[model samples]
Target: MIVDPAARRADGESVRIAKDVLCAGATVRLCLPDGPEEWAKALAKRGERRPVVVGDDRALLRVVSLLHRERDLAGSVLSMVPVGGAVSLARSLGVPTGAVAAARAVLDGAERRMDLLVDDSDGVVLGGLTIPPLRDGRGAARPASPPAHPWLSTCRSLVRGFTARPARAAAPDDAAPTRLRVEADGVTLADLDHPVAGVSVGPAARTGYARVEVHPALTAPGTAPPPSPLHADARTVTVTGADFRYRADAVVTGPVRRRTWAVRAGAWGLALPPRP
Candidate 1:
């Protein structure tokens, strides 16, 4: 078990509960790393042990991204216990949000193969990837995953209850509609001639492909964005624009001029609670 330092600080109780549950069920080697260097060292020495991460969505993404870079992610069969407030990413990927339940799943769950997207820059996106993210009333990106609790609706955090913010001030234009050329499976869905309000791309469940949607900019103030935005299913999706930033796996990335992401069917394995 790898306990993220942030998780230890965020909720010691949940970390303890997860440790106890996991230890009771099976032999465990616990590594408490205070920094990324130590964290990387621990994972490198893990040998044959399947890693169970006890932390929030960021922790999970760290593990996956590291293993992916090392080219071992496909076989790592990772598991996660969402122990912090910003865990919607893990929950959306089917991990239990409760520490106890998630730890139990780590021990008893089945290894399930999951699809993933690989960007041209070699970055990975596990959850949905959004270019010009979906905006809320305040014009900030909505939580990457729908909150499981009703009270979360009012929290305006970028990743839904995730309170961290980029250092940049006055970011209203970041969420505004922008020009981007979108293509899926070689078909152009949106072009630079017309700006798009948002572009969402993610793996379609059980389809071994990506589902792409491009919402056009609103035609009038207070008027709904045009209905029936362009949509497609494809093995690959590409976006090109002057400069844009996007969020994937609940983390923000890039203002790159172009990015191409290809879906790799069953690229990695995750341990998930057995379906009822």
Candidate 2:
């Protein structure tokens, strides 16, 4: 089991529960790596043992990334027990939210293939990516706040009030939306002249394509909303415009002028609890 330091810091109870459950099921080797480099080494030495990540989305991504770089991703089956400050990615992939349940799943689950998005820079996206709605000339509006934890909702709210990024002041004039050229499978989704409010790309229901959506900024009261957020499913999604930032799963990245992510069908595998 590979335990992330951030997971320990964010929710030790969940981490403990996962460990206890996993240990009870089978012989286990606990890997407590302090940082990414150590984490890579731990995974490298995993040998035949199935690598089970005991942390949040970022932790899981790290393992996937390292394995991909080693050319071992397609053949490796991974298990995960989500325990962290952010678990949306894990939850979205159908992993149980409860520590005991997740750990139990890890022990008895079946391996299932999942699709992935590999970008130009070789980074992967297991969940999804989004370009937040532009707010005037100022930087993009902070991505929507993560949903509060159900049981610890109140605590999260209190914590966020103290930690939230200060809101940017409104610009002196009505700033134009960011002008971006978005394409899916080489088909134009959004033209550059008209600024767009947001764009999202994710694994689609179909096996080998990504669902892309481009939402144009709301126009004046009378004008039609720029052709209802363009939507499509494609094997590749590309965005080109001025330097912009985007959120991929839990991490925010990019100021790049262009990025293209291609769908890699069944590029990765996950060990998930059997249905029914």
Candidate 3:
């Protein structure tokens, strides 16, 4: 299945590569941009089968969300060809960068079942939460806000640097740090009030991956904070009483507290290229 937003397909090459793969005997299906809900409905009626996404990280997240919702993740396979902007998450997963290489991976690579995160509100199978400094009046503070045009998003991030706010007393850095109590497998790892530069959780993290991190406000920085509480096989993580926001894959999903997420092990298979 190729769940693509029409905006992404505006590029001529992507469409041509997709058609080339299909013509070469790949069983391809297009999931248009009506909404994920409609795609889910179509998927449900299609019955059990492996799924391959042909868009960026967000598209991959959408398929995972659907599988988790149906509780069919353990038996299904998922793959991707990463054909849009914001493909960093997929790159982290070792998926090839070029369209042809990615397509070949989908067609010939070995299948592997990976862990997925299931939250009460939404489920994501890739990178989650990296809180950068909130953008000023430009509206980059919230994740749910639709991403500005790619150039605009970049320009806005740059402009935020000049208009940065003063630090606050509690954070001592005027950064809007959230007070969060994070627990995993019934053990408390982080319990404090401090400015948080960013937080990321996912299997894609390697020796350098940080399960959790807190830093002084960006405006008050001396040195970057070190990675903290790395989880090699983190199955369950909970975040509570934090006013901070989080980005999952490429979308900003929440500002809610009391969020609990668990990883479903060996949940879905993904396509990859054959070894040379």
- What's the TM-score of each model vs. the native? 0.82, 0.84, 0.69
Residue-pair clashes per prediction, in order, are 0, 0, 5
Model 3: per-residue lDDT, tens digit, 16-104? Answer: 68557744866666656568678787567556545667777777777777777787766776778778777898887778878778777
Better of 1 and 3 by TM-score: 1
Task: Estimate the overall C-alpha local distance difference test score of candidate 2.
Answer: 0.88
Lowest-lDDT window of 10 residues in candidate 3? Answer: 206-215
Least lDDT summed over 10 consecutive residues: which range in candidate 1? 133-142
Top lDDT hit: 2
Candidate 1 lDDT over residue span 1-276, tens digit each:
999888998999999999999999999999998888887898999999989898898888888888898898877889888888898888788998888889989999999988889999999888888887433345446657877887666665546448665555545555556788999989999988877889999878555899999998865579855777887898999999986889888788887889999999888888999989
Residue 7, model 1: lDDT of 91
TM-score between model 3 and native: 0.69
Q: Candidate 2, residues 1-276: lDDT per residue as tens digits? A: 999999899999899989999899998999999988999899889999999999889899999999998889998999999987688889989899899999998998998899999999999999899987554645555676665667577787789899999876676644556888999999998988777888999989999999999988755656775677788999999999888889998688978899999999999999888978
Q: Model 3 Cα displacement at 43 (Å)? A: 1.8
